[model samples]
Target: MSETVSPPDRAHPGLLGQALALRAAWLGMDRAPAAIAFAASVKGIVLLYVAVFLVFCATRPGPGSMLIVALGLAGCAAMPARRTLVIGLTTLLFIMLRPTRSEDLSDFLRRELDLVGSIDQRILIAGAGIAFLAFGMAALRLQSTFRETAPGRHPVLTMMLVFFAILSVALSGLLPVEFAAEVWLFLAALASGFWCIAYALADQKVKQTTDPLPRAAFFRPFWEGPTLPIGKGAGFLAKFEAKDDTALAVTRLKGLKLIVWGALLAGLDAAARSLLHTEAGLPVLTDAMAAAARGTPLPAALSWASLVVHYLLDILHLAAWGHVVVALIRVAGYGIPRNTVRPLAARSLAEFWNRYYFYFKELLVDFFFYPAFLRWFKKYPRLRVAFATFCAACVGNWLFHFMGRIDILAVNGVLPGLRAFESYLFYCVVLAAGLILSQLRKRRPKPEDGFLRYDVLPRLHVGLFFCLLTIFNEPIDAFTIGERFAFLFSLFGA
Candidate 1:
């Protein structure tokens, strides 16, 4: 017998039908030729700007110094012919305006370099910008020229070795204080733009790569995102650039949608913060940790509540910021993926890591995992996978966080700074083990396993694993590894 299909309204009644209808309307506008044309028109651009401004005001108390630059880049990006030149020039301008991401670097320069009156800070920063650009250009040239050479074949590894060599020398104190300070400043610039340069160099090996200027431009791009290279290098963006007006319009509409969604997430984050920390009178995680360190801990129930709430809020905060950055890139006509996806929905630890911070995970996989996998343990499949996981999740993860705290290494002695990373080091090791097991497991939950087994149990296990791992994910110099263990035990009244 033939079965009869329900009408759309009958299938999804009331509010559900209305939601589906709205989504269908959006999809229709997203594809219709006339709608696309209108979206790419001047009036559409103006509307986008107005909407962005309103969202900015609603989300951010201050729109930040790079807002104007970001908006200008978005406008210029709409004109495909001038996009490359505009991006290159604006990136140079941004570097001149703000040379380094870390404010602590400025303080380090003043105190360690003794540049308080010897030279203007602006001049020094400008000099750093010039050095960075020149170095980036030379690196690109080296990669292109020496593609067959060992250094060119593995630029990321070479760069890391060189960076650490210089860092070691600067910290060795063998050179005069003044000269060492100059070296430290150069190191700061290199560290800030390290991954960008790596991505650019990596792109050079590709058959069709961007020009050196545009490639270098992505080193601290006009969007002023975190040092993680959110959209990656020029080659990655080139693949996603809109080819026609219709595509551009669709991309821009998606961008606007992302911005609005990001703004909503931001608002939700703020509301959650206020509700948990203010309304409910729960202490911040850091404050709670500090209290625990001081031999006074909150009740175990409260501690667990704080931990769970903090984890959710942290995901929301990262997603909000990442969405804004990706949206701006999309507006500029490059349809890159969002930096954070549905991490909470992830059913496995490895999957959670992939969803939680995509760009960072990609960075590790590209720079560390691929290299090790291709080179070592080729005859042993499990060993290869485990080794690659170790390289990426443990070694690369630790190095990335350690590089981010370079200013701390400069301020405190190298030994002290290394000690500060002890807790994070433990975190990385355990994370690698968990990820390795997750990847190696032969069987996975399936539909036949039932809802509780297939859906609920795996997610709950993943959540608890990550939540407990948070104890060791302390900031630089926040707590000792032993103290973090103590706090972890306290959660169970041990």
Candidate 2:
């Protein structure tokens, strides 16, 4: 019997296998009650605070503001029964302490309208307070009276129309300059929180309660980015909120992981910038584009390098900031998805878009794509998809960017502002076309295809497409469409 006995054979795991094993182990902790308890315990909170402080030291999203948010989350955790009230009060305090739009509005008033000291800091604060009150009341009314009903059925479209109407009146020069200036200031306040209010209104349809506190909490919530609703509105937050102590602990642990990951990304971004701009001496993308516009083009190879490096850097920057914001949301006990996923792994244009800037895409789909898809070209399935893609990817994209640059309108008036937006409009059109075709394509890479064709080639094509598309996605308004085209053409030795 001893002679017949043999040891069991075990295969050796390679590097990739080891990595996968580690990832599995990491994920396994999320389901373990002891791990959850540790994450939710006081020790866990203290460790989290230390990690957050270190990360914020590197990234610097205003230490004071971050402290306020941290304390607010602690309060919410301590008073779970009054979480909404805590969130509402916290959001109000955060906005009051760091009013996002007040400084811009104040600067505009002073510089453009020559209203220096006419609208002091106190007035600006008062205006913000009034704007919050008005928008909050409007959200409550919409939720109670018009949830899934007429007029409120398309809250985003309604909001857009009203916004444009006000802007039109302000730009008409029909009213006295002082009144127009006042109107512009009011519009700025509304525009600042426009998307937040729209999200709140949209959530009303699915919500059971018309609570003002939840609506107010979502108005530029402490965890949200400047414009995008990272966790979306109340409906999404409610849906994703931790159901138990264990779940809350897991969510918070995940949040800590994200913050650390984001800090790494921030470091990577800084290192990349140093390598490209300092060590290798690559020109800034905007500056290079401006030089090309002025008939002083960089060498074709250098231009190409600059473009690629800039695109990669932009992705890192976005992903880093988005991760931090989403991490904060998760730390507050909401297990929301990350804002940017692994975009480089995308093998198709639509997939890339979905991964690249998730919340922005969601904003478009919620406000533009679904509405157009449901209401138009119902009989023609393909055309319906194409049209909806156009609405979301082209028209909606254009409008969102336009609204964000309302200050340009104040500075340069309507025509010049529109002219400055030409390049971005072109970018959106090409992007929409690419997305539509990607959606309509029937054949996709399969495993049976060789590894290179099935995996590597598609990713390469997607990467190339997005890289080239960035040629026209210039953020600086100083350059014209012609100049952008010139830079693109010069990349090929034109």
Candidate 3:
């Protein structure tokens, strides 16, 4: 079961790496401060939780929040502190929120499951308490357990543990067992990570010869690694020549990388989906779409396809129109010696997009089918650009149209959404025409002595054209820069 990874051929890996690296570096600095701050942050978060409960009590005199808070403090405090009053308090909060009927499981759980919601939650909290006890009794247990593991400890293993711990902490809200155990475990892990980072950053010497705790904390290994030092020969991009010296290449790298990664991830997702549908009794996205079309209440898992499609359509439409505004604004302010080289370089309908309206393209290419497209482009440069451009528009248009069409079809019982191909071509043509006109309108080399065209012509031409576009196009109308104000020009159109 080997998974394929298809990153773009022209993709640069520097940007994402840089963002993460920067975060890690900052975290690595002043470990002790981070640890203490993390502990303090947890205490504050707890108090905040308590305050929220207190507020709830003030509003409706509910015991649920109070119970939760007391239970939490008990976990943090001790066995003697874990009084029946706290449990009673939690039960009361659940009772307040509980419905009159005892039939609904959710409701029943809220009310009846007050003491320990589930066996799993109880185990989680009880286990944590045991661990805390062990830590207190045998302070060296952690060091011993970590060292004496039969499987043997390694940086990779340490990292895996750290990753799982971090994930637990990060996804605290989504935890299935909303019990005292999970909350405490999450808080403790947060403290651990925060303190570990703080300790690393503190002005303290390394007492032990070496702590291979990275076997337990993932990112720490990368931090401890000698290779990633700052002012070192470009930690990630050291091998890449483009990153070595070129700025333009570096700029395109992120966009290209995203194009590459997005495509691979999408493919992987598709394949995983196929496998799931085949092996398990799982329905695919298409099934979800069909259900949505039929006005059937789709299962939550199935709804993801429609949601993704909706978001994709909305975002791309916005990006495309936003780029158009950028073009118009650039032209509107052309009198100030601005350049139109980007627009001019786009020779045809397709190139116009690669030159203008580029973010989505970058997004698509970097993330969607970068590897496939890069290879396809390299092999057939002429057809590559044209096909890629057309496909990008078509898919984007199709998704957008499908979303709108689905809305109409589901709600109004309409047949056939907008033709993806027609709108795709229309988008291409309009953008191409705009670019061509811009190129054709590129100013003749101004003589030093000639009347400065910078003053009036562009103001009349570019500004008027922009205003007109805003009035006519629905997309443009959505991005109006300024009010007409009875023929007055607006400061910002979009």
Candidate 4:
């Protein structure tokens, strides 16, 4: 049977309905007296809190103590070109700021600038130029070869091109040994940003609904953090961009609310850390290990409590930071979602993974999980699912972290760095196994199961599992696998 297709004008009538609803809401916000009163009261309260927090918490008071102002200025400077120029500048910044023993930025730059002006820099620049040309040429060929068929395009070609660039930079010998590592680090930072370019290439090749972002909007958001792309692609980001005056106003308001909420969480994290570490005298993992080695071990309960506090504080810190970053982006007219959510309430390993470090999970799932899932294990559904889960949860997770910390690889060499990652390696393996089991055992809840059995118990179980694994999650160099295991055992009177 031939299905009747709707006309393009009526194809997405729902979008029009949504637009009308939004206009109505905006008009209502202005007209509603009760809403106006409530908004005014909330705004006044938030302003008061902001003032108090700024006075006590935000300002540190002293020379060179206005770090917050410096950060605000940096963000402001980048805000103008939140699309591409910022990425270029930031990448250049990373390249120039090679690791140095020099005590000050001025001294370090003076030393590094010589290397920057050397043949190594030229080689690096030349390599980038050639790579860009190659990508452009390849893209053109793909377009011609595929004959406008989008299905033939793949992200792997772009990824392989990036890998080649990294390898060329690292082994080109056009750079000093120390400088080559830094260059590799810079490339790694820019690697994930390639998603934008890849998506753009695919769109151009296939002629998708997603119009490729102009070249200017391509690279900016990728290197904003440690290789974990904050907002995915320009297409995903388009949904959040403020379309009109009302949207801009709403987005800015949302940004303001986030700033306030982030401030509260930050305050809470600070208080909790002070109470746990300063008042209670409980140490972090590294310090605890040192204490144990000295035979001055803390009580098991106190130690466990400190670890729990550390984990919770870490989550709070990420949430606060994510909220602040999302707020800033929204205020600048691009709406990005929060990176962290209510992870503590997650009912399973899979749920926790999704809630915590959402963008990282998204990156792995998009790039690794789906690809592996579709390509392999078609004959065995369960194995395919589990294997694909492992690819994302373990393999992709490790690669992201390892490359993100390329400085360690530079200083210690590849072997030593891998050695130092033993605990992390174990953690990833165990985590993947747990997540796979959790996925396989997942079931729908019955009303008769009650809240305790269905909700509270499951949440507690997942929380306990993650909390236990937190010991091995730290950089293994900071605390060895044996030390982490011993500490874990000590928590249970071993």
Highest-TM-score candidate: 1
Ranking of candidates on TM-score, top first: 1, 2, 4, 3
Query: Which is the winner by TM-score between candidate 3 and candidate 4?
Result: 4
Residues 364-448, model 3: lDDT tens digits: 3432234345656677664555555444444433333232222222122222213222333344445434534453444532435
Superposed by TM-score, candidate 1 places the C-alpha of residue 179 at a distance from the truth, in angstroms, of: 3.8
Which regions of candidate 2 are displaced past 4 Å?
A: 1-33, 101-119, 146-149, 175-179
By lDDT: ranked, best first: 1, 2, 4, 3
Worst 10 residues of 2 by lDDT: 97-106
Query: lDDT tens string, model 1, 1-494?
Result: 99998766545468988999887876577677777787878897767656665665566643444465555556564565577777777678767655666556555655654633477667777777778778888888877777778998777788889889989998897988767777777777777788889989888877544358778878866666766889888888989998887787788778878887889899899999999899989988777787688788878888888889888899999999888878878877889999899998888899999999998999999989998999999999999999999999999999988886787888779888899999999999999999999999999989899999999999999999999999889555788887777678778986
Candidate 1 structure lDDT? 0.81
Off by over 4 Å in 3: 1-361, 367-372, 375-380, 414-416, 419-425, 432-494
**Which 10 consecutive positions of candidate 1 have the poorest summed lDDT?**
61-70
lDDT tens digits, residue span 294-320, model 4? 556678877777778778888898887
Model 1 regions more than 4 Å off: 1-28, 32-34, 61-64, 67-71, 102-116, 208-211
Clashing pairs in 1: none
Please give the CA lDDT of all the candidate structures: 0.81, 0.78, 0.33, 0.60
TM-score of each: 0.91, 0.89, 0.23, 0.70
Cα lDDT tens digits, model 2, 1-494, are 35776788898899999999987766676677777777778887667656655675567766656777766667766775666777777777655544444345446644534542466655665565466557656756775777566666666677778789988988888987767766766666676677777887777755656666667777756664765668888787888898887787888778877887888899999998998899988998887787788888899888888888888899999999889888878877889999899998898999999999999999999989999999999999999999999999999998887886677787888899789899899999999999999999999988899999988999989988888888787573777889999988888878
